[model samples]
Target: MGKGDKKSKRGKIINGTYGTRRKRKIKRKPSIEEKINVEKKK
Candidate 1:
């Protein structure tokens, strides 16, 4: 196999794994109960 082919294969694997990790880091908006609880704490 050529060096270029090896690099492309590694790049594909890295890209696929990185995408799922990125999605997991995304924050969802708080629910109404969560918002109220936060205000109560303050």
Candidate 2:
């Protein structure tokens, strides 16, 4: 329930770590339309 608790989100954040309670953000790929636009610009 606190910083010492590894299973809690607050604890994960305080420890600067990721776990079941704190999932890392996923990087999104550019959409097909965006890629086409970039190619057109080039």
Candidate 3:
């Protein structure tokens, strides 16, 4: 049960694109420490 799975609204003035504006779900770059830990895990 998620947004992408939902059907688009009919006859809407402004259609949502990628749902980025509605929610800031963009992924930020990982810190230097985090990158090192991830590499160690592998």
Comparing 1 and 2 by TM-score, which wins?
Answer: 2
Q: How accurate is candidate 3 locally (lDDT)?
A: 0.54
- Model 1 regions lying over 4 Å from their true place: 1-26
- Give one digit per residue, the lDDT tens place, for model 1 in 10-32: 45455554343234456889999
Q: What is the TM-score of each predicted model, taking all chains together?
A: 0.38, 0.69, 0.38
Lowest lDDT 10-residue stretch of candidate 2 = 1-10
Q: Model 3: per-residue lDDT, tens digit, 1-42?
A: 244443333212134543423454669999999999999999
Question: For this target, which candidate reaches the highest TM-score against the unseen true structure?
Answer: 2
Candidate 2 lDDT at 1 equals 81
Q: Quote the lDDT for 29 in model 1.
A: 98
Which residue runs does candidate 3 get wrong by more than 4 Å? 1-26
For all candidates, what are the clash counts?
Answer: 0, 0, 0
